[model samples]
Target: MAAPETRWLAVNGAKCRVRTKGTGRPIGFLAGLDGALTWTPFLERLAGERQVIVASLPGFAGSNGHDRLDQHLDWLLATEELLRGAGLAGADLIGSSVGGALAADVAAVWPGLVRKLALIAPFGLYDEGEPTFDVFAVRPGTLQNHVCANPENFAQATAQPAGEDAMEWQVTQLRTNEAAARLLWPLGDTRLALRLPRLTTETLLVWGADDRVVPPSYAGRFQKLIKGKTTIATIAGAGHLAELDAPDAVAAAILEFLG
Candidate 1:
């Protein structure tokens, strides 16, 4: 496949890097914790069938301005602008982890913009009875184990570039973590349950049966709260970052839903 065309655009006052590849009906993808520094095999597979647009959120992948968003409303508005700026209006949307929560918010508040939604281990709900894993507490050396079903997936995802690029890569990871922590620290819930009932878009919740970050059990809660058509697809032997652990399976599930 050809390399994704890349560009920089201003989103909610932050400079964001946007990458686009393939050619067909467009699909917008909001990345999770890592900020989509590079497109993975899973995204490449999706691109084979349709246009895939991935954007690096503020403070991730060298993008800046995450500190500007201090409240949930700030995030919501920023996400909406990203979709519109990327020419993803009315397109099928996919979000993972924190991105999933934002996508759910957009689907609820601006249903007309997202034709369909898919969330992979999305963060937005906190069930004390079934406490989610504390990502912030995990040491840097062990973060991979907590987020990936296969620790090697995490290693690959976080592979340090060689030579001069390595230092920049490390700084980028730190920025990404800080950005994610700003939204997910303490508990990841943003009172999303109250707004989920307002979401009318068809939704698919994809969970990794082995997810430790947001436990697969949380899928049930999402299904219950989303008022529109919603279903769950559990990928066995996958964890929080299932797309990295089981790219083909994740891609297949998303493609089926998009179809």
Candidate 2:
């Protein structure tokens, strides 16, 4: 695959970094709380078949701050505007973690904008029994353990050279976390339960069997909420970041569903 082309899009005065790769059907990918810099092997595989457009959420990466846009609804509106600016309206959508919640919200509110929706370990609804981990409370090392099934892979992926580059990486992580906290601080739920019933687009939900951050049980909750056609797939031996832990499996499932 070739290197992704990067572009800055202005959505409601917020500059968002959008990365594009491959060609053909467009697939807009929304990253998780951690940010969108890391492109998992799953995404690379998907790129082979579709035009993948991944953007850093507001207040992360090169995107400008979103203090003016309050609430999750504003974020969804901004996302819709961003996609429209990129000429990706009616594109296939893929979201991870918080990104998943945003994608679902957009689809529910503007069903015509999304042709298909796929969510991987999405954070939207809250279940009292299967509560999500307090990501903000955990240290970086502990967070890694909660995020990845293979700690070694997490370490390797996050390792940075000791110098200004490493410092910059740390700063980026902090900023990304801060931005994510705005929406997911107290709890990750955005009351998507009530809105999901409005979704009419075909949806795919994938979860890791061993996801500690967001338990696999929430998959059932999503299945029940979506009134449209929905499919669920579980990738074994994977944790919260199933795309990173079981990229091949996750990619295959997504590809099959999108096909």
Candidate 3:
């Protein structure tokens, strides 16, 4: 039971901060679009089971970068370098939301870098002709309404006890949701969605059964598309962020799938 280590490293000159905890076969946990790793219970569960390395994507958390540094594809390269820096060659990868697309893209391009894959309610999967909700037009009440559908998990996430400023911070997460959208051409436009079928690693797709953001129907699409020995597991009463909805359930599902 080693203590978690926090350190910084640079990939292609982009500075990335990695939080590593526990010990065993290395596994990387990626954050979604809004970029925050506040899921202590979930991360602790994984850290206790394996050597966990949570990589902060550049410009999202504490990571910093400069102009001309394209983040989407660059993040894949950065991930490979980060794994190597941690003395890891191949690892189990789990990604949520925006992170899922990153994970899938990485698995497709560097097929040997990943041992298995888990995508939790990933974004960037919409078809070219499909319509998407504009993040900008999403009212706070609407966001909270959709998110709070899973009351138990939503409470766990917002945990906005009396004066914790949790609601304000959530507003921040909701507001900045467009940063990733601005970076990527559009969900599924980069061709990774089309290339999902090309991945050779065993894959696990987890979607919130009641997801409003990226409808559960997309889970069927992922099941039908990815070429790997992929398995899709749906978490009930969860919205887009299944981790926040039911971290324990999501973590358990991941443990079963990855193990």
lDDT of 1 at 235: 96
Per-residue lDDT tens digits for candidate 2, residues 1-259, read 4668889988888788888888898888888755765655667888888888887778766576666668777888887887787767988888888788888988999979988999998988998887898878986566678888987655554555345377778877777778777777788888999899999999999999999998998999999999899999999999887887888898889888988
Best by lDDT: 1
TM-score ranking, best first: 1, 2, 3
Off by over 4 Å in 1: 162-164
Question: Cα miss at 170, model 3 (Å)?
Answer: 9.9
- TM-score, cand. 2 vs. native: 0.93
Q: Among these predicted structures, which one has the highest TM-score?
A: 1
Shift in Å, residue 77, candidate 3: 2.7
lDDT of 3 by residue, 202-240 (tens): 989998787776677777777787888988999887777
| Count of clashes, each model | 0, 0, 1
In model 3, which runs have C-alpha deviations exceeding 4 angstroms?
Answer: 1-3, 86-88, 128-130, 140-179, 185-188
Q: What is every candidate's alpha-carbon RMSD to the true fold? A: 1.3, 1.9, 3.9
lDDT of 1 by residue, 96-169 (tens): 99889889998899979999999999999999999988888877588888888899887876777445387788
In model 2, what is the error at residue 246, expressed in angstroms? Answer: 1.0
Candidate 2 stretches greater than 4 Å from native? 156-164
User: Which is the better candidate, 1 or 2, if ranked by lDDT?
Assistant: 1
Q: Tell me the TM-score of each prediction against the true structure.
A: 0.96, 0.93, 0.81
